[model samples]
Target: MKQALQLLVLIFSLTVFGQNGNTDTAQVVIPGRYNSVEAQAKPYVIMISADGFRYDYAKKYHAENLLKYSNEGTQAKAMLPSYPSITFPNHWSLITGLYPAHHGLIDNYFYDYKRKEPYAKSNKKNAEDGTWYGGLPLWGLAEKQGMLSASVMWVGSASDAGGARPTYYYPYHEKFSPEEKVNKVIDWLRLPMDRRPHFISLYFPEADANGHHFGPDSKETEEAVHKIDQAVGQLVQKVKELGLKNVNFVFVSDHGMIKADNENPLEIPQLLLDKNRFDIYNSQTLLRVYVKNPDEVKKVYKELKANKTGGYKIYLDKKFPGSLHFSTKDDRYSRIGQILLFPEAPRIFLEKGEKSTAGKHGYSPKTVPEMKATFYAWGSAFKRNITINEFENVNVYPLVAHILGLKINGPVDGKLKVLKETLK
Candidate 1:
């Protein structure tokens, strides 16, 4: 048994060391879609989620290393985030392979009718409770199968998502800087082999926060982009210096940013739910107005649809289009508001006497191109210098599972086949 273990370790060393520094058609041995012992011990995958990073940001900012890596490895032209493309939802989608609706993180914040509670990013209690988030996340899955995993402030990392926390994790801390997070990941990487995580998840929020405070086109956003690029450069240099073999590195974003203006905000003469005797829980981009009297559902929907104008629309939850894949038939069909509204780029939804200015996401990736995220992966298992035009972001969960040779059993919407073409 010990000899077999030693052999596995040697295979891992060869897989990583054999392909070091060979930029020309270089490849490393990976477990080829097989969940064998060799596959389990072969590679280390590090996933970095750069908040609100648009697909074009790489080229727009001339981030040399990102551009060069994507050019040399596998990159998706655009990664289509799930509907209501907000932070928590899409971030969860990337790890769970389920749409926001199924994952139950429908928006950055939403109301849960059954529990008569509201789930918001600010609420630590709800955020840490795994019950609210249905599907399994990659880190939790790793722990379940006796593999070590680490997370650095990635959304839901604090949660007992699949009934366990990562072997190593730094809970979301607002004061944490990009440099600090990167340094910590490097620390985790340098741990002894038995203590080191096979999978690591990292998050950076400067660009996303700046993109919201200053529109995506502003100098502030540009500088923030550069800062993150430098941080990534540091990560690559350190990894290469450590001579970590067969390490798979993925740099991606939850969703993209769009320039938003409050100049001609969508006007709602009536706070429909309030006017109709109801409580309201609303996110900047989506609203879930709880009707005190269920019979008024139609009345509320009608009033909202009637008062809505440019930049936004109102619809009954029941009548929401199927293409959005937000149907509640699978779960929580009743939790969302009876009425729904979505805003277009350059449009902000404000109540009768509201005001704002900032960039935003949550818009459909289908129309507002800026809302589309980015995906890039390089190392042993992925194809080199390949570019796939576009792909659904949900498939990312499966892609990670495939790279790790994990056989996940829970139901997931993302199909492995969708991402197979991009892998070796």
Candidate 2:
């Protein structure tokens, strides 16, 4: 058992290290950009996302620095993730103030019937393409309003979403050390007033990676949480040394983690696997079926619905639960599949012979407590020692916008009023 655990750790190390080989770590600076006079006067915000960090992780894992900092300012009981609580969707939701359906990234991997193309997070070309994303992300909003922004590695930051990427950004890569990332933020903060980024985003992948490989309750995950806690402490210390005023930090996670029923995984229904009948996009937690022949939709739905066993729920796209905001009415881009399958907590769909990860997420937070993410804010902008009830992740965009004094260009699902009370 000890040898097996060591092998898993070594594999995880190699997976992360392998991505760094020959990968460019230079900061990409878009020339000819400067903060407008109004933007220059605004306060600074550093939004940090520790992917897969659960709501209770700080307390549960004894993340001392995070608990300390949050206790000093504001900490929410929990932060609810958007429907289909996965990495790409929720990150975009947090940044754009829109639900996944509204933002056009309904899932980490999904087929767009209109575009006749697939948007997979692992596909570098499409992931970097700005056109695939919708809703003006916070970085784009800042840039549009003449505030320079920087991103160490935030989803959609590397793309030209809303016709502008962050003025300073590094395309997503796993090679850079955590210390290097912190120093880069310090460098950006140290730039000349006009050139410095007022809005900066930093991302950490350790918790999520370890959680998936070793399960949320494992010692590996606890250690990963501690690493994040230390990194946060280091960042706060370094930033304080700079004596930057009105600089606030908002920490969040895209979604939480839960152990999966890996030993008894559900296999896809045989009827749905026929190539001529359906195009299936499976994410373990959610299975989307796009029927080829429109007429066959009812027949297939009936067969699958009647034959479906335990551990999952099936819904036709039009009849999907309205609360999830993933029903047909909310699909702005018509990207959602015709039929949807959502597995209950700890249950996931896996084909025969395919291995399941020890940990999994993407369940609806409303139904599964394990899907709830994290949110904590501290620094000059937030009220001290306050705790608020759980709120939707979309509200984060408006709160950040409010901090930076950026104007909301259009209607967004997030409302500043929801989080306005947390401010000093």
Candidate 3:
């Protein structure tokens, strides 16, 4: 029995060290004025994503509660979302503090022509198998440090990530009532101090769903936002009720919705090409075209470059031109199609039979409103009554990693610069 126990211990250590041998220690570069220890020992951190909530919507629609939160907390001029700016990819980016390419989720849907399988947001097989997701989410980082973490409704939260999962999670399901969702978050906060999570994320999807069914400017959309705000109120009130005083709350969004264009469906006919030449899949605003041969790929690129395209702006994935700030490789979420078809000024991507009443946001991140989103933080650790200049989503991870004391393995695209000004 003693020999068996020793053997088990030996195997476990070897397995542990083997997997973490390459794990990089997180590095901290403190500013001259602030002490590292003080920054490291801050407080509880919570991030919330109100799906499809636009930067202007809150201000324009009289979302006073949210605006008050922003007014009192450290808010940004604008929160620039990542490219394609879809839900799943953007949410994944928020957690990993990585762009889609680095994180491996390019859009809500990806085509695997060889396997004849496509990855969509709700596809159970892809969600459960975990191949569709890449990188470590923020909660996973907190859990690793002996700190508890919880999430109410984050994309991929219920999915297995990096083999282990969140200490607390609730799967995304249509059957979940808004009240139930709010209560679940409140319930998690009610856990005893020893069991309380160091990090928590709450997600509300009503606004996005409503925007999709009814345009962003509609009454239905307004009602949805109000309802979500009430839920936010419930969450904030409960945190106080539970005396979770050492907490910071961040309110953000995936990407704002746009009214769908109904003029003409942006179409790419594979029938126009040699059937053996390309495999085409359309995901809303972008068309992913994968070709069989490199030579054929060149021919396609040339044709797209010289053509008087109808309503599509095309680019070769390997050499996605400047101004887009998007990586060319699809290795992470950055893997773009050989020819990406971005809808013209009045057009958006659509399948043969797809209809959308709500606007979409997969256009270039530079689109005036589409690029714009929200970021507001309030509570114990943040400086009160400060709104800083605009920053991109890439800057978000470092701030989060800093708060949670998690080390990022690679160089973060954005700096700890934003927090430098805000946290002080």
RMSD of each: 12.2, 4.7, 11.6
- Which candidate number has the best TM-score? 2
The sequence of per-residue lDDT tens digits that candidate 1 reaches over residues 1-424 is: 2122212211201011112243233111112122235434658899998888899998998888888888889999899998887888888999899988888888655667688666666555777788888789998787767667888878888788878678777655554567877788888778667666788899888778788878788888889888888888888888888888888888889899887776777654366534447655444565556677889888767766666666676666666767677754634535566666776676766655444547877777888899999999988888999999788888988888888877888889999999888777
Model 1 residue runs over 4 Å out of place are 1-40, 269-276, 306-308, 330-333
lDDT of 2: 0.88
* Superposed Cα deviation of residue 207, candidate 2 (Å): 0.3
Q: What is each predicted model's overall lDDT from 0 to 1?
A: 0.74, 0.88, 0.67
lDDT for each residue of candidate 3 in 159-185, tens digit (9 for 90 to 100): 677544567775555545667777776
Positional deviation of residue 298's Cα in model 2 after best superposition, in angstroms: 1.7
1 versus 2: better TM-score goes to: 2
Most lDDT-accurate candidate: 2
Q: Give me candidate 3's TM-score against the actual structure.
A: 0.84
Task: State the number of backbone clashes in model 3.
Answer: 8
Which is the winner by TM-score between candidate 2 and candidate 3? 2
RMSD of 2: 4.7
Error of 1 at 139 (Å): 0.6
**Which 10 residues in a row give candidate 1 its minimum summed lDDT?**
9-18
The candidate with the higher TM-score, 1 or 3, is 1
